[model samples]
Target: MPAEIALLFWPLVTIALYALSRVLYRHYPSAWTSPLLVTPLALIGLAIALHAGYRDYMRGSHWLLMMLGPATVAFALPIWDQRALIRRHWAALLIGVIAGSALAIASSWALASALHLDASLRASLVPRSVTTPFAVVVASDIGGVPELTAVFVMITGILGASLGSWLARLLPLRSSLARGALFGMGAHGAGVARAREVGEEEGSVAGLVMILAGVFNVLVAPLLAMWLR
Candidate 1:
């Protein structure tokens, strides 16, 4: 196939794979079936079969990534909707985001260090705990590969969602606030989905916490980048 046609086709393939993955997950609903897990694997397989490198695929799909910024901004509406709850639990939400973001960064750094990964990989790992849009921004700011950081974010989210569910069940996280915060802090987007499966209030709180954490991480990323340098 011509390069131009291949570029266009790859983007469609990527989108179709993701859409199909979501459908499969809706029906078969498990960690392995999750779109975050299956879409990437399917895309990788397709790309490999087509001899398409990351750059080739990204050339067409970059627009989707650009949409992330607007999507992240839209998260603010959730905060506005939950203003009353936000006012009541301002301290908890604030403290939870701070602590969660810190721990996530520290743990990623330590894990990368322990593995003796390169500095760029370490930087990519730093924002692995946050969602994609924030992680991509942080990655670029901190001399990490945004694409690599996005992959790490997906892996972290899948694992976090799985573990967050288990923890919610095992731990005495009785309150909606605690349960929602637990998933939001632990898993971000994936966690919010799982939290929604549990309850509406939990879903709302999780979404708020996830947005707050993303905004906080984006704000702190510059300082963190400088410190690393």
Candidate 2:
């Protein structure tokens, strides 16, 4: 295929793969079978099989990347629908998110330091808990590698989505909102998807929490970076 044709075709191929992964997940319904878990690996394998360069794949994949910001902002609609419940617990939610965000930043820094990573790499890992769209921007602003941040975010999401339920059971958490908020703040979109598996209320709360965590990290990460430096 010509380069332009391949570039145009990759996006459709990516979407088809993702859709097929979702269908498979519905049939299998296991942690490893999750669409989020499966799709990226499939894409990587497909790319390797085709010997496609990252630069070319991204030429098409950028379409989905471009949509990420708008898609994230659209979460507000669900939040607006749940405004009543949110208002009732606004204080608790705010406190929980702030604490979670702080912990996320601190823990990432500590781990990176323990691993003896360089400053830029440490910065990239700092935003690992936030969703990729937010994490990439934050990482760039903080002298981190945006690509590395995206990788960390993906790994975090997959692990969180896969293990979160089992961990929750181990913790014996009683509140759906708490569970949702933790996962949302810690794991981002994949966690939100997993939250939906529990209940609509959990999913909505997770979506809201994910948005809130993103906003919080955006505002706080740069400042923290400066202070840590």
Show pairs that collide, candidate 2: none
In candidate 1, position 124 carries an lDDT of 87
- Compare the candidates by lDDT and give the number of the best one: 1
lDDT of each: 0.88, 0.84
Tell me the deviation in Å of residue 21 in model 2.
1.1
Clashing pairs in 1: none
Highest TM-score model number: 1
**Candidate no. 2 TM-score:** 0.91
What is the alpha-carbon RMSD of candidate 1 to the true structure? 1.4
Candidate 2 local lDDT, 167-212, one digit each (tens)? 7678867898888886788778989988888888778888888888
Indicate the residue-level lDDT of 162 in model 2.
Answer: 68
lDDT over C-alpha atoms for residue 33 of model 1:
97
Q: Mind giving the per-residue lDDT tens digits that candidate 1 earns over 109-213? A: 888999999999999889887878888998999889988998888888889888998899999876899999998888889999999999998999899888888
